[model samples]
Target: MPHFRIETNVPKSKIPQDFVSKAIPVLAKALGKPEQYCVVSLIAEVPMNFGGSTDPCAIGNLMSIGALGVEQNKKHAKVLFELVERELGVPQDRMYITFQDEPTGNVGFKGTTFHSLFG
Candidate 1:
């Protein structure tokens, strides 16, 4: 249930055209989740400013039911930031990533919450 989303100030045309397919496995590995269950969404050309300046920057949001912790989060951030930089040419120093552990009951799919199936 790891849904990795990125909001970047870079234009969509500047990013690698095949980023979604390239990012799926990356996110899956970062979350230790199955590739089929991982979803990645990218929003480019966002009007965002990091460090009070307008430069190539991004903010990533990783949401999952579990598999997020201090060490895992740091590792994920490094991997995610690298992917962003490599794919979009966004500097890693200008990126900020936020991790969220969603409750099983709060996440739903196919008309059923994960809480019902696993919790």
Candidate 2:
């Protein structure tokens, strides 16, 4: 599973209604994961600031069982940052995204952990 969570200072009204729809496919393609197993969430109107400014900045994280690493994350960042910019009007420079390589055992799905299912 790949879950992309974005916390932004942008108001809820400013976010596009089709934001999640647009993000899932893009994120799935970037992570090379099936869209069915990918999740995307946006928390708008968050109290956040970046570099002493609060002008539509965001903090995001991508947590997944695989498809994340030094070189891979760079590419994911480009795609995801573009998505956030287009959907939330948050500039690429103002957003920070963290990549996480999750252990299968650490993630639960369908009433069981990935580790148990895959192992």
- Top TM-score hit: 2
Q: Point out where model 2 deviates above 4 Å.
A: none
TM-score of 1: 0.95
Residue-pair clashes per candidate: 0, 0
Colliding pairs, model 1: none
lDDT of 2 by residue, 25-114 (tens): 999999889999999998889999899998889999999998999999999999999888888899999988999999999999999999
Candidate 1, residues 1-119: lDDT per residue as tens digits? 88989999998779888998999999998788999999999999999999999889999899998999899899998899999999999898998889999999999987999999888
User: What lDDT does the true structure give each of the candidates?
Assistant: 0.91, 0.93
